[model samples]
Each structure stands twice: as C-alpha cells, then as structure tokens.
Target: MHSLFILSVMLSTAVAAPFGLVAKRPLDDRDWTRSKRDGCPAYLTEGQYEFPHYMTQVSKSEPNLAFGPQYNGIFTPNDVSTVFSFDIPESRANDTCTLQFIFPRQEQLKTSSYAYEGTGTFVFTGYNPGNCPGPQTTYNNQPGNGPFPQFPPIHMEPGYAYTIDVGPCSVGAGTCVAGMTSTNDTYFSYFQDKDSCPIGIYTSYS
Candidate 1:
C-alpha cells in the first residue's frame, strides 16, 4: 500500500479551511505590477507572474491509465503521485520570490452526502536536474523528488483558487520540476477531482 507520508499527516475533523497548512498570501494586488506572462523579466521583481505547466507525470503500477496527474482530471486518488515541470527563465530565478502551484476548482466530484475532508498533508518537493517536462519524466520518478517539507492538507471548496507554494528553490533552477503527493487518502480529502477536468493547473510567482 502507499506508506510514504509526511509526519504532519494525521486524523482531523472535517471543516472548511480558511487557511492552508502552508503559508498563502491573500490576493494582494499591492505594489505588485500588472499581472501578466508576456515573458521573463530582466530579473526577479515584486509582482505576481502567471505561467503554465509544461508537462505532468503520474506514478502507478499500471501505465497508460488515467489517474493522478495523468488523468485529464487531476483527482490524485490512491497512492498516485504527480510532478509538473516548468521552464524558469534563467532571469526569473531568485531567492526572494516564492513559486506557487495554482489549481482552480472546476467542479465538485463528490456528492452532497460526501463529507469533505481536508486534503491530507501535501508534500511538495524539487526534482533534481530539474528539466522541463519531457519523455523521461514519468510517474515512477520518486527517486530524486525529495528532501522537502510537508504541509498539512487544506480544506478546499469550489469557486476559490487553491495555491501550493513550493518555495523559491525552483525559482532560479532552470527546468524546475515541482512534485506533489497527499499523505491523506480519504473521500473528503481528495474529492475535488470528481467529474470535470482540473488540468488547468498553473503557477504564480512574485
């Protein structure tokens, strides 16, 4: 079975989470410049930049099956883990800014009877030799995606955008590989991916 998990994963009551386990900044349209993804800036600056993921990888005993990251729908059920590759322009690398994985809720998968559980502890890590998603990046890539901190799962409701800040480590690292896995495997925890596609996953950095 899926035994690998972060120390923070634990049994908890079900309720809406106003805040996630990891730090998430309020939608502050402060001094940050106009949000856009025209191209890499001369250097890192104080602004929220939008970027799309190049590719995604899923790990499962069976190949060619849709689940986890592979599923046009990112349900993240079972023991499946996923990785997303992003090509951070050398100029975009910086230690001060944070890299965030943004997942917009498309629809609710579970029914009204289904009690939503907070997402179990989510572990985000940096893959070595971070390269843009390619043929080599697969679901079985658990070897080098590690040595990162685990954050408690967050309660997610539809209509709101969820953000997972993977830290600045991948900011300057060219071909940054960001990975995610849930320690909690429950109906309420990962019920976000039920019917429609949630592949609109992207990243935001400032």
Candidate 2:
C-alpha cells in the first residue's frame, strides 16, 4: 500500500513534465566538444578549459573597510563562490536526482536588505547535458532540460554527473552595498519519472 502511494505521486509528477523522463542515448566523448555539438559557448573549444570551474567572492557587514570588499557590513549581506565537478557513472545511468542552490537565511541579512521571501538570482554557465536542448544563452539556463523528462523539475542519474560554472550575480545593478556582494546561481541535471528511458540531466539558470 505504501509503495502504491509513492508510485501514484511519482506518476503525477511525470505527467506534469513535457519532455518525459526517458532518454534515447547518453553523451559520448565527441558529444562533449563543440565541433560535433551545436550551441556550445565560445569559451568551449576543441581542448582548452575543462567543463567545471569554481566561482567565488566574499563580502561582510561591520565597518572594517579593510577585509576585501564590504557588502552589507559583516552582517548585512555576504557572498561566496565555489566550483564543483561531478561524475555520473554508467552504472547508474538511469536514476533520478536534483541539484539545488541554497541561499543564506533571510534573518542573516540586515533588516534593510531582508525585504522579500525569495529575492535573488544566481548566474551560471558551463557544459549542459546533451539531452538538454538549447543555444545556451544567458548566465541562467532556461528552456533547457533536466534528468526527469516528464516531470517539470529535473532529476539526475545516480552515477553520471556533469560539471557547471557558477558565480555570484549582482542584485539591483546599483553599486555594491557596504556588505553585500550579490546572489549565487546554480544549475542541475535530473531524471523525469515518466517513461522507460530513465536517464538524463539539465541545468537551472534563473
């Protein structure tokens, strides 16, 4: 009975996604390059930079004015950047997963800055799983794909992984505040829970 409940929920989610959760193929070595693949960024070439690189920055509140750059104060707004690479092994090529970009608690920011519930965006770039269709515009990847095809949200295969380039995107477009730098962006690969071909990956850019 318990299993049936879970199955029902999964089915519901699959029905919601358009692409469906199954894939016809996996990316090969040639698939990873620009010549063979269309929509690759200018920075991506035959053999130069790799797939993943970290993007980081730091800011604080207080009033030292000495520690790098002050954003909202050491307590107002802060920023940090890092890169990560993942390997999705062929063994678990057909599973479901999700990549999330967590943010600092609202209470952690100054009262002046703590204005909304979800008021930030993360800038992102890098190689996208071949299953995801696109010309690869904007730092934030949208209209792309994730692991789960049928489900609106993306899913990831347990073993197979892709690298992403991430960074802190400035908010408001105004000058950097005393202690706040901006927000972080991230992407993800996911497996939709719809059909038989169950392995795939995509990213998040908003």
Candidate 3:
C-alpha cells in the first residue's frame, strides 16, 4: 500500500520532533521544585542598545564592534584577535544568565599609544536541572567585574573552555574591557589594546 504509506509518513515525522518534546515523566525529588527565585539576569539577550545614526563621517568614529578593528579575527591589514558568542537554550533549566563586555572607558583613557589591551575568561555548565539539589555551582562574575578572578562551571556534556588573550598593553590604562565566556564555548578571543583609546564595548548574551 505505497510501502505502508511510506512507513507511516516516516513514523509521523519522528513524532513531531523537537527532541520529541522531552519529559517522559521522570523528575523525582518533589517534582524538581523551584518557585519564585529572581536575581540572575544582569544582562543577556536584552543587552545592546545605542543610537544616534545620521551622519556622513563626522570626524570618523563609530567603529566599535565591541572593541574596534572590526573585531580583529585577523584576515588582513592588521589583526587584533576578537570574537564572541552566545545562544544557549536546551530548555534553560534552573535559569541563570549574565553577559556583559562593556570595554570602552572614555576610549581607553584617551589612546595611550596605538591602542590595544588584554583580558580573557570562560565558564559554562548545563544538563540535569529536572532533578537538581546537588551538583549545582556557578561563578564568573563578582570582583569589581572584569577578567574573571573567579571561575568554575563549564561543563554541559558537550563542550566549553574557550579562552585566548595575547597582548602587551597594561600600564594601568584600562578604561573599560571585560571578559567572561560560555555560551557553551564555541570560540573566544580577546586582544586589542593598541595603546588604548577606542570606544564601543557593549555585548550581552543570555
């Protein structure tokens, strides 16, 4: 009969995929309780907004793709290694997301010379939130903020730990520059301190 209706439409399209809608009733521990717990949304997703568009080169400025040089991932001219990422949602269990890369302190204190800086960090953790209570820990922000001094939590059963920072510009001139990685670590890099003096460092991923 048409090969059994093409194997029942390929098993009904794999049971309406989407990981088959998960949850086959198995969440023990009082059904994984967690009611009304707020205080973990410092900026991620709803974390980028700046406007004033209307110009034709007003002294040329506005090339701050988070840290200038088109975020130097090196492909020509002059590189400064710059890359970032975010997009984590496997169901978002126990919710907790914070992402900020605001590095532009008065344009790195007015260009120290050539302009370049340094910073690096990383952390991520996921899986099993349906039966939580133990095996839970997190950190990556808390310490005047910038260049993580406290790190731990980069294990989501897939991949993590993507840190890179090559530089030589730290004569106490860091107007603004921050780092913290783990959107499940796909890639990361930070190296732009050409003597300092470049603005635009606003990135958030939740």
Query: For candidate 3, which ten residues in a row score worst on lDDT?
Result: 1-10
Per-candidate Cα lDDT values, in order, are: 0.35, 0.21, 0.20
User: Per-residue alpha-carbon lDDT of model 3 for 1-206, expressed as tens digits?
Assistant: 00000000011111112111111122232322232242112222232321111101000122322331123221111121122222223333223322212232232223322222222222311111121111111121111222213234221111111111112112111212222223222232223222232222221122
What TM-score goes with each of the models? 0.50, 0.21, 0.18
Worst 10 residues of 1 by lDDT: 5-14
Candidate 2 wrongly placed segments (more than 4 Å): 1-82, 104-119, 128-206
Residue 59 displacement in candidate 3 (angstroms)? 34
Ranking by TM-score: 1, 2, 3
For model 1, what is the alpha-carbon lDDT of residue 137?
52
